[model samples]
Target chain A: MPTCVGVGSPPVMAQPNNYMKPVGSDTRFGAVTRVRGRIDGDGNLVVEGAVEGNISLRGDLQLAVGSEVTADIEAQDVDIEGTLDGDVSASGQVHLGPGSRVRGALRASAIIIDDGARFAGRLECDFDMPAELEERRR
Target chain B: MASTVIGVGITIEGEITTEEDVVVHGTLRGKLETKEHVSVEQGAVVEADVTSNTLMLAGTLTGNVASGERVDLQSSAKLVGNVRTARITIADGAQFKGNVEMDV
Candidate 1:
């Protein structure tokens, strides 16, 4: 899988300062790689391999297609297009993209499952119900 | 290009096994085993036993290394461990404190 987090963007001249680093500095675990431990990062992480450990990141997490992850993940945002067998806790949005196969509970601010995605888990999203639905329930 | 890259600002604590090449530019504290080459880039810090076909270090490594082919310690490398390999090269300015077991 290609480890292109933000392709076709303007090249950064210099680091300038912390928190303004370029997007290409994100971490990538390519195919044929297998990690059996815990990953803690302050940058975005893209997985295109097999991971059997927990992932905790301050940035977004992307599980590329053909990737297999069997660990719980905690990130700001999560986008999965692979096979995941663990719970996901995202402070932002959690998207199960096409070709994703997930089997775990998800807790996020918002959750989106694409049409081609296969999911077998419980969702715990925080969203306000429609006023009509709230009145009908009462 | 390396198949597995531990990029900057990332810290991995555990075991990593790969069939392809690996490049570390961050912090790794565990064991690393690879069938191909392994490179520890500059500014990286590795505290683990590394097993690979070919090992190259340009950073700080504090563990044993067993390489099948060769091991190269660049000038910017600071390694403190034993190295067992068929061939080895330690460039000038490399800070190394370990035993070398070459397979003559």
Candidate 2:
């Protein structure tokens, strides 16, 4: 007969599978849907609809093609391929794809503007100039 | 799949207006107006007034509902709101506590 360990067994403690995993939630808003408020959460968000408020997320934010947004956004990272009319502040990278029309200030560690994207905003990024460029400025 | 899907971990606290179908699996606390069907799936919670063409509820709702076509409450639904629609059906095991107004 096999002996059964009681509740106070030494090796009975096990960590959950998601113990060290980041928040892996995802939210998607499809086309033809419109929202008029604020959204703040800890998950990735994909928007293919219209939003008229502020958005703050701890994960990536994607604004798909044909979507329209009129709100400020703050996220870990951002990818925009639609129309945005608000400021964007990201802790990570921010990319404005082709055909995207953005009209606001952008502050991110790294920013990329693709060809054919229309943007009218202030860019705030930190860069280290090379030695040759530093000599030219003297 | 519905045109609009609110995932299980998301929450919205405002107004939503859609021209296509909507499915909710999270929490919403505001107003919802749509031109198509709306489904509040299981584990979802909606505390808002909903106006839609039709509604299929299997979650919890605590507000008023106005549907143009019909409203169907599944067995797992728990609703506490007044309903005004052309047709309505409440299945067994469903809990509802509100007035139902239908056209004669």
Candidate 3:
């Protein structure tokens, strides 16, 4: 190891992958009164209370377990681990984690419905229908 | 870390009541009432009535404000509203247009 100065510099940050969670604040809407309005942002947002409106973001969104939300959402990535009753449009991927209950249409490039997630919505994802199946239908 | 933060690119069009600290680096239109300190960062826009224990504003505020502790308006703050606080400090470079009610 190299010799260091007397008063050393602060610790360097780890690699991006080493940071498991997103950067922005948790933005927790604590479990109390419902939040009503349109939320638009470029940072990652996590909701734990009740919300009724539209959530539009450029980064990511996570709904914690047991939380209730009634809002249409459009984001780069979305993780649902709670109760949602609105349409979700994700540009990247949408993950419905275990124990989540969701209702409404979902459109994303990729989607995951983990085991134990209760979903009642029209799921639309990018699909490549094989030519053989198309020929059979023709 | 504050429990709630309205991120830079976010905008809220309704009321926000929290029992914890709230940082606004985005936009809020309606009302904000908290039992803790609240900071409105520079470049943010708040057109709502604000109530907090301590209020620190460095952005554009266009509503009435009531704080229990104090209200500090930074140099970059542009406020156009009434203020009802126990204590208030207006930085030299700040722009304010409101009635101050220190009696409250």
Which prediction has the highest TM-score against the true structure?
Answer: 1
Q: What count of clashes does model 2 give?
A: 0
Candidate 3 lDDT, A1-138, residue by residue in tens: 221111222223122221443355435566543568888866677787788889888777888887899999998778888999999999877888788999999998767777778899798876666778769988
> Where does candidate 1 chain A have its weakest 10-residue lDDT segment?
A1-10
Best by DockQ: 1
Candidate 1 segments exceeding 4 Å error: A1-23, A130-138
lDDT of 2 by residue, A1-138 (tens): 211211211221122233333333357787988999988766677899999999988777889999999999998778888999999999876788887999999988777777778899898876566778779999
TM-score of chain A of 1: 0.82
Q: Rate residue B27 of model 3 by lDDT.
A: 87
Error of 3 at A82 (Å): 1.1
- Steric clash pairs (candidate 1): none
iRMSD of prediction 1:
1.4
User: For all candidates listed, what's the TM-score of chain B alone?
Assistant: 0.97, 0.97, 0.96
Provide the lowest-lDDT 10-residue window in model 2 chain A: A1-10
**Model 2 chain B: worst 10 consecutive residues (lDDT sum):** B1-10
- Evaluated against the true structure, the overall lDDT of model 3 is 0.81
Native contacts recovered, each model? 0.79, 0.64, 0.54
Model 1 chain B scores worst on lDDT over the 10 consecutive residues at: B1-10
